[model samples]
Target chain A: MDIPRHWRLRKQRYGLVGEVCESCNAKVFPPRDICPECGKEAKTLYTFSGHGEVYSYTTVFDAPAGFDETAPYTVAMIKLDEGPLVTAQLTDLENRKVEIGMPVEMVTRKLRNATDERGLLVYGYKFRPVMN
Target chain B: MTEKIELLKPQRPVGIVGYGAYVPRYRLPAKEISRIWTEGQGGLPVTEKSVPGPDEDVATMSIEAARNALKRAGIHAHQLRAVWVGSESHPYAVKPTSTIVAEAIGAVPNTQAADWEFACKAGTEAMVAAMGMVGSKMADYTLAIGMDTAQGRPGDPLEYTAAAGGAAFIIGPAENSVAEIEASYSFVTDTPDFFRRAYQKYPEHGHRFTGEPAYFKHITAAGETMLKATGTTPEDYAYAVFHQPNAKFPQNVASALGFTREQIKTGLLVPMIGNTYSGAAIIGLTAILDVAKPGDKILMVSYGSGAGSDAMVLKVTELIDERRDKAITTIAYVERRTEIDYAEYVRMRGKLTMK
Candidate 1:
C-alpha cells in the first residue's frame, strides 16, 4: 500500500500553521516559499494557532489512488484563527457528522507510513474536531 | 535585385501537414492502484498509466512533436520560418520555453518562436496565431506544438489524471498540407470552473460547479458554433476530439451535444494518460491525425476550466496517410504501456514515499 513520503517523524505535532506576515499581515501555512502579499517573500516563522471553523469539506468517498485503507476519510477546508483557511482531514468523527463551520482542533498523528520513491519512511499530521 | 513592392499582404493557406505521438512505455496498473486505494487486491475497474522518467518535461515533449511534424511536412527544421509552443506549465516560470524546443528541434536561427499560455487552450491558440501569420504571408511555414506536465494536489482526486504528454503540427500552404483547417470557432465566459493559486502546490476545484458551467457549457457552445458555422451535423465528421478532463465528462458533454459515443472516442485520453492540462485535446487531435484516413473531417473542440473553448474543423489530407503507414499511431502508442502499482503511483505522483 502507498503512504505519504514524509511519514517517518517519530514525534507527531498534530496541528496546522500559516504565516501572518509581519511585513504584511497575510496568513499562510505549510510555510510559503515566497509571500504573495507585501512582496515580503521573506521566510518568517509565523506561528499559526489552529482550532478553526470549517468552511467546507467532503466525505472523500473516493480516496486518492493510494489512500484506500483510509477510505471514507473526510477532507475539509477550515478557516483558522489566523485568518487563512486550509484543507485537512477531519478525524474522531463520522462522515455524516462532519458539518460546515463545525469547530475543530488540529492534532498531529501518523496519517500513513510507507517507503518513499527514494525508499524512506515518512510521517505527517492531520486534523480532528475538539469538543469545547 | 530587389523583392517586388508588395502593397497588399499575400494570403497563404497554412494548415497541419504532419502529426505524431509518444506515449510513455511505463503504465501503472489499475489493479495495483486499486490495491493501495481500494481493497489492496485489484478492487477497481480501471487502471491509470504514467510516463516514468525525469528528463521528460514540457520542453522535451514539444521537441518530440516538432520532430514528427517536420518529418511529416517533408522539410528539415531549418526550412521552417516560424515556430510557436503553447503551454501553461513551462519548465521555468520566467524563461521562454520555446527557445529550448526550437534549439532541440533545429528551428532555423532568426525564426519567430515563443510560448503561449491561455490555460489549456494555449496550444490551439498558438495554432490560430500561426495560421493568421502564415495566412497573411508573413512566413512560409510554422510549427505549433502543445505540451504539459499536469500537477495535482497530493491525495486529491485529480491526482488520478494529471499525466504529462505532448503533440505537434506543422502548418504550411493548404495545397501542400496534411489537414485543411475547414473552420474555427471559439467561446469564452467569465467563469471559474477550476483554478490553482500560485505556490499553492495544487488546484482548487468547484466540484459540481465545474461540470455544468465551465467545462460542459463552453465545450458545447464552441462545438455548436463550429457546427453551425460549417453548416454540418454530428454525422458529417468521422470523429470528434475534445479536451478531455476525465473519461466521463466527455461522454456526458458529447451526448448533450448530439455527437454519438463512437464519435467522441477519437480523443478521450484523460482516463489512461491522466489530464495533460494543455495537452489533453490537442494530443487527442494528434491521435486522430494518426488514425484518420485522407479526406476525413475530424471536428475538434477544446475546453479550458477558466471558461473558454475553441472549436476547429480539420480535414485530413493524404500526406498524413503516408506518415501514418510509416510512423506511430494512437493505437500502437496506447499498447506500449507498462502498468505501475498504486504504491509506486503515490511516489511518482509525489503523494507517498518509498520509505
Candidate 2:
C-alpha cells in the first residue's frame, strides 16, 4: 500500500503547523478555514511547539477487522499550550509510563497501514514522549 | 398586599394548530414479550408495551409528533418563534436535535432553539421553558418537545419500560389557547437514583432506590407544592399527568396522593408505549389535551431520576374545540406501533450489536 497524500504531506514536514485567528486569538490545531469565534476568513500561520499534555485517552482493544495485527493502540485528546485540543495517539511510552497529564510531543510514525507489502496505504498521526 | 407578577406575557397567542404521531407499524403480544423478559408477569400490570421499528431513532420519532402538532395548529413553520427539544438520548451530544426537527418540520429563518435534557421530564420541562419564554415575551410562539429512544442494559426490568416515543407542544398566551398555562411549579432534590456514565451507553440504576427517592418522594413533593401553590385539592383536577415509567408506579404514586383513575388516563401511556424517558410525561399531556373540554383543569408532573420533579397545572380554553384533532390520540399512538423480540430489543438498546 502507498501512503495517502495527507500522510505524505505530514511526512514532508517533520513538524505540523496550526493556525491562530488574529481577530479572536483562538488557536486551531487542524487549521480551520475560518475562525470559529469571529467568523473571519483570514488565518495566520503558526508552527506548534509540538509539546502538549494528555487531557484524556483510551486504548482500543476492538479495532476494525483487518487491523487485528495491530493488537492495541492508544487514542487521546491532548491539550497544547497554544490553547487548543488535538486528537492524536500516544507512543514511546508504549511499554513504560503514561499518565493523564504526561507531557508529549508530535512524531511521524507509521500507524496501521490498511495494505501490507502488496496493499493500499492508510496512515495517521501519533505522539511520543518529549526528551527533557 | 398582593404579590407582584414580574413575568410579563408575550404578544402573539400560540397554540398547537397541527399534530401527528407515528408508532412503528408493528405489534407484540404479552405472552411473546413475557417469554423473553424474566420480569414480566400476568396479574397486576398485564399489557405489553409497543416497540419501535429498526429505522426509527429519537429524531424520527420526534418528527412524527411535530408533524401532528403542526397539522392540528393549521399553521406554517414560518409562524414559529422558537423551537426546543427535550431529550437525554440525543443522536449527537454536541449537535442539537432541535435543529434537525426544526428544519424537517419547517420552523425556520434560523429560529431561537435548543435541546433540553433533564431525564424523563425533559419534554415537559421544555414545555415549561417555552412557557417562560412566551410568558416573558421573548418569542411569540415556541415549540417545546420531548422525545427518547432510550437504552437499558439488556434483561433489566427497565428494558420493558424503556421505549421510543415523542410529544410536542406549541406555547403561546391564552387568547385562543387549547390549554392555557394556569400555574407551574417544580421541586428538586439531589437524589442519585439512576445514572449512565458518558463512556457507558447503558444506564446503571438502583432498582428500588428509584422508587422512593426518585419516583415517589420527588413527584409527590412537587405535586403537593403545586397543589398548594394553586390552593386546590385532587378533585379540582379533571386530569393528572405524571412521568409514567411503567404501568404500575405512576398509578401507585397517584392513588397514594388521592388521584382516582378518572383523573389520569394520560398516565396509562406506559402500559402501551413503554417508558419513553423524556417523552413519558409529555406524551401523556398530549393525550389529555386531546379530550379536554373548556374549563377542565389538569395537573402535570415531570421527574428526572438523578433526581427531580416539576409539577404544573393547565386550564383548558375554549380553543380546545378548535384543535381537538391535533394531538396523538391514545389509540393512534398505540395501534400503529410495531413489536420486536428480546433479541431485536437488545439490538436497538445497543446491548448487542453487529461488528
Candidate 3:
C-alpha cells in the first residue's frame, strides 16, 4: 500500500474509528460519509469499543500477495457489541478452536510489510481471543 | 570542598499515574529451542519465551500497552504532553516509533515524542525522562514505554532468553499517582558488554564479560547509591525487582544486595516469559504493582548493556487497589499462552529466508 492511502485510513485502522449516523443512530464502519441505514450524512466520528464476537470465520491456506508469510491464518467476520460487522484476521489463536461466537478484542498489529522490505511497515488493528 | 551528585527527583512530586504491561500470546519453549540446537544438553535459561506474531512489532505492541495504560489512567489521550518509546527493535531504521505510538494512542499534534536507546535499560531511561517532564511541570503527564520484540542469533544462548513483551507507565502529579516516586539514582560507565552494529541482524556479546564487570558492577552501584541516599536498608522495601536478562541475573543480584527470594519472586517473570530487553525491569515492576498494597515500599533497578543501571524507590498509594483492576493484569497475559514448536517459531520470527 502507498503512504498516502495508508495515512488516510490510519484512524479507522488504528482505533476502529468509524462514522455514526445521527439521523438513524446507526454505526457505520469503513466510515462511508453517507449512512446506508438512513441515507443521511453520517459525519460524526466514533471509536469502536473493539469488543466483538466471531460472527463467522474461515481459514485461508492459499495466501494473497502481501500476506503470504502468514498464510493458513484465520479470518473472521466480527460482530461488534455496538452493532457493526467488520472483517479481520484472527491472531494469538494458541491452538484454540475458533467458535462462531468466541469473544475477541482489537489489538494494534502490522497489517503487512508494504512495497518491499525497505518500503513501509503498514500497521493497523487485528483481533485476538479476549484473555479471560 | 567535596561535590555532591544528588539522585533525580521531580521538582514537585511525580508518580506513576497509570501503568500497563503487554506480553504477546505466543510461547516458544526452551526445550523446543534446545531440541533443534543443543539436543537438550545444557540447562534451559528460561521455561519459554513470549513470541510476537508475524504481524506484531515494537510499534504495535507499544500501542497496545499504551492503550491499556490510558484505560487505567482515566485520562484522555489529548491531555498527554509527550510520548517516548524506548526499544532496540523498532521496525523502521529511519522512522520514529514514538510518533506512530503517539498517533495511535491519540496523543498527537500537541505531544513531544521521541525514541530512546540504552540497550535493555532503554525503557527506564524513558521513565527517568518522563519523571523529569512531569515533575518539573513541563508537562502535566508523559507516557514512557519500554518494550521490545528482541531477536537473537538462531542458535545462540541469547535465543533462549531474548523475548517479546513490554510495559508502559504514565507519569503524572502525586495527587493522581498510584505509586509515588520518592527518588531515583543512575550509575553509568563506558563498558562494551554487548553491541549490535548499525546494520547487523543479530547482536554480539562479550560472553561472560556481560556478567561481573558490566551487569553486576552498574546494578550494585546504582542500587547501593539509591539505598544509602534514601537512608533505607533492604529490609525497608516490601519487594525488590532487578533487571532480568534471565531468571538467574535478577535472583543473583537480589541476593547480593540482601533482598531475599521471597522479596523478588513476584517480579521474577523471566523464568516464564524470557527477557524482554528494554521491557525487562519495568514489566517486572508492573507485576510487583499488580499486587502491591497501600504504603508498600518497592525497590526497582534496571541495567542496560552499554552499561548502566537506574535504581528507583516507590511507595504504593492507597489508590493502587482501585486502579490495578482497571486493565488486564500482567499475570493474565503470562497465563494466556499458546505453545508453538520450533518450525512455527521460525516462521513467526522470520528466521528462515525466503525468495
Candidate 4:
C-alpha cells in the first residue's frame, strides 16, 4: 500500500464513513462515487452508526499469506442497522461464540502490518459484540 | 513568602458527565505464566490479566470506552469540544491516538484532540487539562481517556502485571454531571523506578526500589496533601481508589492511609485484571462510581512509575442515580470473561517470533 491509498481509505477505515444515495436513500459502504442502488451520483457523505448484527460468518483455520499469524479467526458478513451488509473480521469474541443476529459495533484497529520493512502500517475498522 | 501548592479546583466546578471502562474479554491466568516459568512455585500477584486480541489496542479500546462515555453523557458527539487520550502504548509510534478517537466518535472538525503521556498518571493528566478547559469555558465539554494494551517481556516480572484495558471520562458543567470534582492535587519527583527506553518494547523496573521511593512515597504524599488541602480525613470519604499495580500495593497504601479494605475493595480490580497502567486508577474510580450513591464522597490517588501521583476528591450527585442506567456499568464488562490458556495467550499477544 502506498501513502495515497492509505490516506484515501482512512475515513472508511476509521469510522466506517460511507455515502448515502440521494435518490433511493440507500446506505452504501466501501464508499463509492455512484450509488449501487439508484445508479446515480452520491455526493453526500454518510457516517454509519456502527450498530449491526452478524448475518453470516466463517472461521478460517487455513493460513493465508500475511494472515498466517492470525489463522483460525472468524470473518463475518454483518448486516448494518442501515440497509447494507459489510464483510469484516469479528473481534473481542471467541470463534465459537459468534452466531447470526449477534449484535456488534465497529471499532478502529490494526488491519495488518506492513509486508516489508519500512512500509506503513495499515489500520481499519472491525466489529465486536456490543457489550451492554 | 513561598508559593504554595494550591489544590486544583476549577474556577467553575466541572463534573463527570459520563464515564466508561473496557477490559477485553480474553483473560490470561497468572497461574498459566507461573506454570510455564516458575513451575507454579511462587504465588502470583494477580489472578489473571486481560489480553487484547490481534485487532485491539489503545486506540480500539479507547474508542469503545469513549463510545460508552458518549452514551451515558447523552450528548451528541459533535457537541464535544475536546478529546484527550493518555496512554503509554499508543499503537502508532508517529500517529496521534486522540485524533483517531475523536474522528471515530464523530467529534472531529469541531474538537481539539491531543495525546498525553505521563506514565500511568497520564489519564489523570488529561482529566486535569480537560477540567481546566471546560471550567474556564474554553470548551463546553471534553473527553479524557486513559487506555493501554500494555506490554511485558517474556518471563519478565513485568509480564505478570502489564495488562490491557482502559477507561474514558466526559467532563462538563456541574449541572449535567453525575459526580462533581471537589479538588485535586499532584505530587511528582525525578525518581526513575521504572522506564522503557526508546526503541525498546519491554520496560525495566527497580524492583524493591520501586516500592518505598516511587509508588508508596508519591501516593502517600499526594493522598496526605490532598486530605490536608481539602480539610478532610480518610474516614470522611465513602470510598478510596489508589493506583493498583497489583492487589497488594493499593491495599497496603490504603491501610497505611487509614482506609479500610472495605472502602477500597469496590474499586480494586487489579487483582483480577492486572495493572492497566494508564487505565489503572480511572478504571478503579469508574468501578466505584458504578455503585456509589448520591452524596457519597470518593478519594482517588493514581501513581505512575517515573514516578508521581495525582490525587482528587469527588462527590456523587443526585444526577448519578438517574444516569447510572444510561450506559452499562463497569461490572457488566468485568463479569463477561473467557479464560484462555497459556499457548493462546502467547499467540494472542504475538509473543512468538515469526519464522
Considering summed lDDT, which 10 consecutive residues are worst modelled in model 4 chain B?
A: B346-355
lDDT of 4 by residue, A1-132 (tens): 378988778888888889999998988887987999989988688999888999999988885766666667788999999978999988777745887999998877777632233466566888889876
Q: What lDDT is reached at residue B279 by model 4?
A: 97
lDDT of 2 by residue, B59-113 (tens): 6567657766776766666678887888888766677777666755656555987
What DockQ do you compute for every candidate structure?
0.01, 0.01, 0.63, 0.53
- In candidate 3 chain A, what residue range of length 10 has the lowest lDDT sum? A111-120
- TM-score per candidate, chains pooled: 0.67, 0.68, 0.97, 0.94
Per-model C-alpha lDDT, please? 0.67, 0.69, 0.91, 0.87
Tell me the number of clashing residue pairs for each predicted model.
34, 22, 0, 0
Top candidate by lDDT? 3
Docking class of 4: medium
TM-score of chain A of each: 0.73, 0.77, 0.93, 0.88
Q: Which stretches of candidate 2 lie above 4 Å from their native place?
A: A1-132, B1-22, B27-34, B37-46, B326-328, B347-351
* DockQ leader: 3
State the lDDT of candidate 1 residue by residue for A31-111, as single tens digits.
Answer: 664666677774664545556788998886776754544566788898887776677777646323777888887643334
Query: Per-residue CA lDDT of candidate 1, range B35-128, in tens?
Result: 4455554223234745533224576567656765766677767667777888777766666778666655656477887888877788887877
Candidate 3 error regions (>4 Å): A113-116, B1-3
Among incorrect, acceptable, medium and high, the docking class of model 2 is: incorrect
User: How big is the positional error of residue B286 in model 4, measured in Å on the Cα after superposition?
Assistant: 1.0
Interface RMSD of 2: 22.9
Q: What's the distance in Å from true for residue A120, model 4? A: 3.0
Alpha-carbon RMSD to native, per candidate: 19.4, 16.5, 1.4, 2.1
Model 1 chain B — which ten-residue stretch has the worst lDDT?
A: B2-11
Best by TM-score: 3
